[model samples]
Target: MLLEPKSLDNIIVGLLVDNFFKWYVAPKDLWFLDRKKQADAYIKKFKEIGLKNIGNKIEEVDERKGIEVLDENSFIEFIRRINKYAVSTNELRESLKLNLLTTSKQDTFYSFLPSLYVNVDKRELYSLYPEPASYEDFVPKNWSGVYEDFLPKIDWEEKYWYDKNGIDLLNLENNRGKK
Candidate 1:
């Protein structure tokens, strides 16, 4: 999805805030609690720190700077301004790699690829599938042959749709048993 610059900025800030809580606050403050309790405590701390209102501060800065789009430097600056506990820019960039940012360009813009895809390198994003304990667990025994047969024909280059004719193929498959 194409996100507005402000929306993207908000998301980045949120990640920074969450990271701050996870690394700085959680260990010292919420460690003894269960996962659910820790999450509740994290929310309380997040609100108490005024991090929730950081979006307004960001807007003011963006308005003053006349920044319609956020590039790497500007993004880093935003994170630094909002998050006093933020890690170094290099560390931030390393964390963002594949997790939030991708090298894939949509036209002139660097696209933020979804989590399902990993940015393997500067040139490509690879699909991240779950690792099943066995081949039968990954795909049903009945569908294994069909899955293998069609896997190679999948168009990996198509970012949005693996198989361009997937819907047609699916319809054909669905109708096969019916007829």
Candidate 2:
């Protein structure tokens, strides 16, 4: 039976497929031989990342033991479940600052803010919308374990955008008297 693609095996396969196309298919390399060879490099990377037991054949992906395929309904249900448990960036940051939350709950760092803008600085409304987990600022577990080995070198005050092209619509800072 198919299930939501949340399982580790599914995630790995998704990553592999994405990497394969990025390294081969998208480059417009018309030669099948060249593309196939490029795909081999990605396969090697997948294997090096502990998927060696999955065998050496990419064509055998479906038969893989740990492969848990998700159906349409199940995928929707999984997304709903994730959203139900997710917390906003504000909530997550506050909780982390107070030590009420741990990095283990990082998956719940939701950031889907609403498109509507409330033009008020002192009377700002609490955003009821939660962001998708795919946001760059919303880190997930599938990431390389490289970051775990070192302490963060950047100070929080440096300021940066985590969501791509996401910006404040209200411009509240400069809109106080314009109303």
Candidate 3:
């Protein structure tokens, strides 16, 4: 899974769902203090973190693995699920967008490119299925080429504001205040 800290809700949901699989579906003893307790903990954390308000049910995600995070095949399925809950309420969609800062003037940091936002985030592998150990499992050939061509399309200066001038401008006000 590629995780963007900017998408806290998505990350939390993904982690809880993953933990649920490790605790119950796989029947791993060392994964938690107890399976039931672990499930409850996951639920509580979800609620505490405000995911429940967004209609993200921590209990509902199927534990069966082999789910691709973002690919052509999985994109359709992911959109269907998102529409089921997201389309019903306008407020929820806005909340989600706001939470992700998808419309921030700063640039799109979180993209729902298949599932939810691709931010050049680092990838980690956690699967319930006996698949390849990491994201290497789903990566297509020409991966480097994909990055070279596709990544450049996303203007990093506009999106992440990492340029030296941008950094200096961002800190200018604070630096002046300190002086």
Candidate 4:
């Protein structure tokens, strides 16, 4: 239940720090147009706009009273936006090169949690909730075909069969060697 940002981002940040150690010497400098402030503002805006689908946590610094520490999601989004803008302006790719937004396998899995984007294999609109998870009469508005043909059919067995005496009827020991 407790999820931490993937190690890849940490590695990327470490690399970035190593490469741009001089840039961080002055935290107030705005060479990249006050990126830290922008990140904080964007996080606040996203939270305000009710787009907090991705969890974000900010650690507050004493001097930076209202502002909070940047978490991976906000940082990554900042990088993504910067990259998009840079590409639009025909900026050299190397100029905006950063690996902070690189998604790892875990990020990919978590990305699918809030919204699903699965390709329908055969097409009867599938509801991925509930159980044997089927309701034959309930057709979705956008009906896609089903992959029923590919589904492995289940051979059901009674997991619990209670007899009149309220005991498991399938227990072999109940009908032992006497017979």
**Which candidate should be chosen as best, given lDDT against the real structure?**
3
Segments in model 4 whose C-alpha atoms lie over 4 Å from true places: 1-9, 13-39, 47-57, 60-179
Summed over model 1, clashes come to 0
The Cα local distance difference test for each model comes to: 0.25, 0.24, 0.28, 0.25
Off by over 4 Å in 3: 1-70, 82-133, 140-153, 156-158, 161-165, 168-179
Question: Model 2: residues >4 Å from true position, as ranges?
Answer: 1-42, 46-53, 56-75, 100-179
Against the true structure, candidate 1 reaches a TM-score of: 0.17
TM-score of 2: 0.21
- Candidate 3 TM-score to native: 0.23
Per-candidate count of clashing residue pairs (backbone under 3 Å) = 0, 5, 2, 8
For candidate 3, the per-residue lDDT at 171 reads 29
Between 1 and 4, whose TM-score is larger? 1
Residue pairs of candidate 3 with colliding backbone atoms: 111-117, 112-117
Give the top-scoring candidate (TM-score).
Answer: 3
Model 1, span 1-179: residue lDDT tens: 12211111212111212222211100111111122333344566678987664322212232214333223223344344434333332333333343334333341122222112111111111221122211122221122111122222222332221123333221212322221
Q: On lDDT, who's better, 2 or 3?
A: 3
Candidate 3 lDDT score at position 151 = 20
Q: TM-scores for all candidates?
A: 0.17, 0.21, 0.23, 0.15
TM-score of 4: 0.15
Q: Candidate 4's residue-wise lDDT over 1-179, tens digit each?
A: 11221222210111021122100111111111223444555587788988875433433323334323222223334333223122111111111121113554344322211111112222232222122313222222343423232111101111112233434232323433221
